[model samples]
Target: MTAGHCSDSGPFNSDGSVSFFHLPWGGIVGRRLIGPMARPDMSVADMGFISKRNPDIGVIPSIRNTDDQEFPELIIYGTLDSDTVGSTVCKSGYTTHVTCGEILAFGVTVTFLNGMEFNGLIKATHMSCGGDSGAPVFQFAEDILPGIFITGMVTGGSEEQGVCVIEPIAKLITDDIYVLTINDPI
Candidate 1:
């Protein structure tokens, strides 16, 4: 799941209609918004989905950490348990790119400037900025074939050091839907 603030604009046109998905490299990917799901109270989880199966834009389970090379593929086979704590984690996003840190706290509550309070969060030392709201937080180890797509960082704090608050993947799962993951084709 993502932070609710990321999709606050609704990804729609001024006429109140869904907008087409534009690829970063300038091409119509045929992706249509399925609508965003968020708490009216502007709580912790902010999630959305899109459908691009018609033209099959292709989904790559990878993240770009450096501008000098290709994206590093990550095989996501599972998720981190809610009780998981004191684990090393990493996140990749548009702003900060990629950062690694440790989980400092779990099942914590935080209040945003909008006066919205979110509970059951995973606080870490990872770095993130404004545009990094929806970036995936995961764990990668040497022997692990598929990393765990743990959560998404919603907010960042600590003026001197980079601290991020993440919405745990465990809390994002509902009866209707869950996050998607994939294994490397090799």
Candidate 2:
């Protein structure tokens, strides 16, 4: 689960191969997971996946929350019902770390300066940097569950305006690729 534009930028090889590192400086690497209709060379849908790298590295189903001393990493239970316009959402990226904001709108279509249009995007007021393309967009749900819900992934954003665009995770879930969750629904 990464933005298609991320592959267009970096983090992935030319053949759609990607490796996930456990730490920011790369401690443990994760296996390459395949995605559906991934834009390897383009950023049309802003969704992409990396091919197989090392199958030995272990991966976990969690979201980063450095502010929480009790629970540094939040477990990913599942997604909630449908997010509304006023729903509070947060994004986690290495550049910005974690920024929280409300959803402005959904089903948006943004066109970049290079004339590439990406549809099915959710617009939010959170901040993101250039290299934060594949960041995770999620919402913490303590009432329904103690963990966070993996909502979507960051695609593009306006650094000046302090806003970001995300693509819903539901669109990326296929028979093969999926988010590892307990209550995962197909």
Judge candidate 1 against the unseen true structure and give its global Cα lDDT, from 0 to 1: 0.59
Predictions in order: lDDT: 0.59, 0.68
State the lDDT of candidate 1 residue by residue for 12-124, as single tens digits: 55654333342342225644443334323344354444334344345555544454254455656656664556777888765666677788888778776666677878888
- RMSD values for the candidates in order, in angstroms, are 4.6, 4.4
Candidate 1 ranges beyond 4 A from true positions:
9-44, 50-56, 65-71, 82-84, 145-148, 152-161, 183-186
Measured with C-alpha atoms, the lDDT of residue 29 in candidate 1 is 68
Error of 2 at 134 (Å): 0.9
Most accurate candidate by TM-score: 2
Q: List the residue pairs that clash in candidate 1.
A: none
Put down candidate 2 lDDT per residue, 122-180, tens digits, no spaces.
88885654567788778888785447887888887897877888877776666887787
Number of backbone collisions per candidate, in order? 0, 4
* lDDT top scorer: 2
